[model samples]
Target chain A: DQQVKQNSPSLSVQEGRISILNCDYTNSMFDYFLWYKKYPAEGPTFLISISSIKDKNEDGRFTVFLNKSAKHLSLHIVPSQPGDSAVYFCAASAINNDMRFGAGTRLTVKP
Target chain B: DVKVTQSSRYLVKRTGEKVFLECVQDMDHENMFWYRQDPGLGLRLIYFSYDVKMKEKGDIPEGYSVSREKKERFSLILESASTNQTSMYLCASSYPGTSGFSSYNEQFFGPGTRLTVL
Candidate 1:
């Protein structure tokens, strides 16, 4: 069973606009959530993450929000740039355990 | 900078052939993992190792095996290649966090190898 899920397969946004990618998880034991961005023919890179204890964490233009009660999380990128277009994956894991990944969402930023 | 390196960027193999995909990390990470990426199915964990000479089966381990004889190197093996095994393979490594939550350490990934089995 897939414990982590990304409902949307793709998301398109205009450059300089806010892009929101959402994820949901069925496993409540997950305490850490992470987002990874992947470019064509490249490996997934670590993006942003949020701990279950905190509701939100931000780093410059990227932010991750976690709603533990709802078992949901979202990645927000402000002023999206054309270079930001890539496949984004959401993953969650319990302490010291292997992570569960979502199917992934492809984000397209139009200039 | 943290770096994980894979043996191949792409490979083609025939059915019944044995294949080896090797991964090495320069970051001195204690945990290493192998995952296969396929369309729609996303990234499925094949195998992982938390220490030298130790291995654990992930979500999908059938027909696949892994080796971690050293801390920096991990190998994924396909005993008898099949068409269904064609996919992109990713290797990742992460440090064991001080808090005992290995997930706390961000995983660094290699460029990945695209393997095609006929």
Candidate 2:
């Protein structure tokens, strides 16, 4: 069974607009969440992370919101640029367990 | 910068052949992981090692074995290559956290090796 899930396979947004990508999880033991972005032919790079204690974390143009009670999280990018187009993966993990990743969501920011 | 280097960027092997994929991390990290990435499957861990000579099975470990003789290098061995094993293999490394929450540590990944078993 998939513990983490990204219901949307892809998302498209216009430049300078806001893009929202959602993820859900079934495991309650997950206390930390992270987002990784990947471009074609490259490895994934860490984007932002949030601890279970916090509901939100932001880095520059990217923001990650976590709702522990609802077992959901969303990644928001404001003023999305064409360079922001890539695959986004949501991962969750406990203190001792390896992070479980969702099937990534492809984000396309149109010029 | 943390650098994780894989032995190969691409490899092709025939069925029943023994294949070895090597990974090296320059970060002096204690944790190393091997994962296979498929189109819709994202990334699935095949094996992981927390310390030299210590290894753990991940979500999918069948037909795979690993070795960590040195702290900087980890090797994944395919006992018998199969067509279904063709996929992109990724290597990642991270340091153990003092807070006992190792998952909080960000993992640095290699460029990945695309293995094709025919």
Candidate 3:
């Protein structure tokens, strides 16, 4: 069974527009959620994260919203640029360990 | 900055060959993990070690083994490599207790190793 799911396999956005990527989880035990960004030929880098206790977390141009009631989370990038185009992954962890990752959403920001 | 170094950037081996992928971290972190990345599958954990000589299987540990004899090093071993095993391997390290800026669990990942089993 997939505990974490990213239904959208790909997303396309125009430059300077906003890109929103979604993720959902089935296990309620997950309390920590993290997002990672990856470019071609490189490993994923940490992007942003939110805890179950918080509803939203923002970092620079990126913001993450978490709705525990819906068991869903989303990453929002305002003024999306071509450089922001890449694959994004949402991961969850319970017991402060054993992270579970989603399949990933490939975002293409057209210039 | 936390530096996690992987031994290989790309490797090619034949089926039934024993493969060893090594990872070293200089951050002195207590937790190390190994994961495989595929096209449709993001990243799946194979194994993790919280301390020396201690290991735990993750979501997908079949056809894989691990060794951690020291605090800064973790190794993933493929007993017999299969073509299906060809994928990008990633190693990550983090401070064991918590994650993120406020007592969090942010992991630092190596560049990655792309392995091809022919």
Candidate 4:
């Protein structure tokens, strides 16, 4: 069973537009959530993360919103750039630190 | 910056051959993890360690074993590599499991080792 799910496999957005990626989880025990961005042939890099206590967290152009009640979280990239195009993954972890990752959403920023 | 390195970026092996995958982290983090990534399946955990000589089985650990002898290193072993085991293997490290949400607790992944078994 997929405890964490990214229903959208791919998303396309025009350059300078906003890109939003969504993720949902079935495990309510998960209290910490994170986003990772990966480029081809490279390891995934940490993007943004949000805590269960807070609904929103922002890091420059990247922002993550957590909806505890809905078991959903989202990543928002404003004025998306070409470099921002990549496979984005959302991961959730309970108190145990064993993280479960979603299938990932490929973000394509068209120039 | 912390860097997690896998011993090989790619490997090819024959069925029944014993295989060893190594990983090392420079961040001195206490937690390390092994995961296999397959297309459409995302990343599936194979094993993880929180301290030397301590290990735990993950979501898909049927064909894998792990060893953590030192603080900075963790290893994954395949007793007899099989065709179905062929996939990109990744190593990651982070601080101890967090009970609360913290962005800095994000795990850092290695470049990944692509293994092909025939």
Index of the highest-DockQ prediction:
1
lDDT of 4 by residue, A70-103 (tens): 9999999998999999999999987755789998
lDDT of 2 by residue, B4-107 (tens): 99999999999999999999999899999999988778889999999999999999999999999999999999999999999999999998988643777888
Of candidate 2 chain A, the 10-residue stretch with the lowest lDDT total is A37-46
Which portions of model 4 show Cα errors greater than 4 Å? B97-104
In the predicted model 1, the residue pairs found to clash are: none
lDDT of 3 at A109: 100
Tell me how large the interface RMSD of candidate 1 is.
1.4
lDDT by residue (B16-117, candidate 1, tens digit) is 999999999998889999999988778999998888998989999999999999999999999999999999999999988786437667788999999999
Higher-DockQ candidate of 1 and 2? 1
Q: What local lDDT score does residue A85 receive in model 3, on the 0 to 100 scale?
A: 92
| CA RMSD per model (angstroms) | 1.1, 1.0, 2.2, 2.0
lDDT of 4 by residue, B21-92 (tens): 999999999889999989878899999888889898899999899999998999999999999999999999
Decoy 2 TM-score against native = 0.98
The DockQ-derived docking category for candidate 2 is medium
- TM-score for chain A, prediction 3: 0.98
| Model 2 misplaced regions, further than 4 Å | B99-101
lDDT winner, 1 or 4:
1
